[model samples]
Target: MKLDVTRRSREAMRAYLAEALDGCYEGEPTISPIEGGRAAAERQLSNFDVRRYASRNHVTRGHVSRMSPYIRHGVMTLREVRDAVFARFGRVGESIYKFVFELAWHQFWQEVYAGLGDEIYADIEDYKFPPPVWQETLPDDVARAETGLVCMDEALRELYATGYLHNHARMWFAAYLIHHRRVHWSVGERLFFAHLLDGNPPPNALSWQWVASTFSSKPYYFNRQNIEKYTDGTWCRQCTAACPFDQTYDALAGQLFGNA
Candidate 1:
């Protein structure tokens, strides 16, 4: 159907979906800030910065390209993105290695999905540590962005509002849900899949597993100090909750996993 999407305003488009897909889709239809289509994708690609992405991707407010939605939707292909990087930055060396490696990691997940299919929905391996009985569903507080932790609450609000979350934020949120709150990794994976613009089953599931210690050699948890440093205390500065992550790793491990 050569439908002119431009004919309808964002509200009209959302209303159409709500009427057309009724039970299949719920909630208020908020548009993503990321634009769609080849033109937008190309523009974003043209502005790619390899060096800053490499150096700052670990931080919340990083220089990483927000190309995920375009790439995920096939408005741009992985090869196209990789070629764009090389076209601008020349052959991969120290500067572009981290960015290219990330692209490669994305491809690696795609390959794994192709090979394993639905098996990735289940735990790929056993947990590295004895795990507590985890909640089978995402908690109402976390889902509603009311989890008193400013970092997690803000991340959830962003995910709900934009269908996007910075990678570091995603990690922190997942760790908070899986380790701090003792929710199942699958619960978090499903929640992300439902909201993320770039949500792919392989990476989403496996990454959650990695955080939960079901696929990795160790569970990934972050302390208040790490969050404060990377986010430049953006969330911590205003947070008033009894900070659960405000402890050493050894303390967290012992408290979260000891005798579980």
Candidate 2:
């Protein structure tokens, strides 16, 4: 089971895995361009400035730490990350709250899964919206990033090529699939599990349910303005597709949930 890294270049390692584990995986054989191992993890952590993170982490090209793969795989622990942040910035402040809350959020999902086990696969609560007429599978257009919506298409393409999507994009895609497209939350959850490098059931599945309004008080949907604000209009500027997200929140709510 040991990979002999002594002689292989990164590309060679990727090729080796693709050949060795062929048919064991889906899609093209790929490795994240993000490097692995403790040294790389330490370097990423060292470069992460909590100050910049607090202000920009929600945006498309934000100052995210890029430590997700490492933390997800245990190359870095949540405690280690928290301690690292605390060492640099004091634990008690608005600056650290968002970043810390993210860590805690992941941990909270883990705890929920631990307690509920396979029950997490079922609805934890009823949808806050009307009963959904749900599709059980990811659509071909979506799987291939041909949805014609720039944001969703780009997010899917990013996931296919790099095995990563920004958190904002993930939420948007989930909401789109579940609400706009009438696909089940589990369908998008499985799509993410199949592709995301940091895909872990507790957060991935639960977050999808939360967005689908099966595990939260309401569904989470976003408007074009919200996307433009967070992405700085990057996708919208180039996007020629008729935007499903162009409506106001009230309009979206009625359109998506009124008939439930």
Candidate 3:
């Protein structure tokens, strides 16, 4: 059998987002956002606005987040991507391992999240919820923040302009969104699914929980300055990668790197 994929580079994926799927969504999130968190682990919503991903750089929405949804929904399978890679790299050794690792990395996280306590769907139990809230009560301000409009960083603006974001940048983005902004990661998670083309529920949802300390907190806060040192002045001018907190940074970076 011959399998031909017209590859959509991260760049191409961004361009095709809203354009490819706009006619879906009849009402406002049939499943309310907060309550929806606990629904069926995840729901596969097909059809999205083509215009949503058509910004000169909308690939962030249409392409990147779309992958996991399709894979999760049975529209496509991980096996397909694997077969394509295996054909080129074959089995065994680091070369093949590297290729397989990326896909597996995605899978591993999904599993990790499924087992998290049901509370994983929301913020840490210990934290207090202030305002009376509901699944459907998503404020427009919160919507703007997750889209990277709340912050004034070039990395974030680019994230807004382009739908795609480097995985590394997402970590920083989530932490800042959850911590600095005082917004719940679950809120952030919902926005991600709404906008991301490659949004994988497991990785996307659980990762947000992890960052918010509902999961783990060895490096309590990812240092902002440390990231600047590592990136060497590239990416995230508005939000530096260096973690603001230190002790947690030392302990956490280890787990993060190991996991990554």
Judging by lDDT against the true structure, name the best candidate.
Answer: 2
RMSD (Cα, Å) of candidate 3? 12.5
Task: Report the lDDT tens digits of candidate 2 across residue range 107-168.
Answer: 99999999999888888998887776789988999988999999999988898889888888
Q: Rate the local accuracy (lDDT) of all candidates.
A: 0.85, 0.87, 0.50
Candidate 2: stretches off by over 4 Å? 1-4, 23-28
- Provide the RMSD of all predictions against the true structure, rounded to 1 decimal: 2.5, 2.1, 12.5
TM-score of 2: 0.93
Q: What ranges in model 3 sit over 4 Å off?
A: 1-75, 109-120, 123-152, 217-220, 229-231, 235-260
Better of 1 and 3 by TM-score: 1
Model 2, clash count? 1
Q: In every candidate, how many clashes are there?
A: 0, 1, 35
Using alpha carbons, what is the TM-score of model 3?
0.51
lDDT of 3 by residue, 3-99 (tens): 2248634445433543454466332222212111212222322222222322212222222223443465555567765664455445656545654
lDDT tens digits by residue: candidate 1, 1-260: 23357775666665676667768755776677776789988888887787677546455667888888887888888888988889888885776877778888889988989998998888888887787898998788888899889999998889988899999999999999988888999999999999999998899998998898877888999899999988889899989999999999889889988854
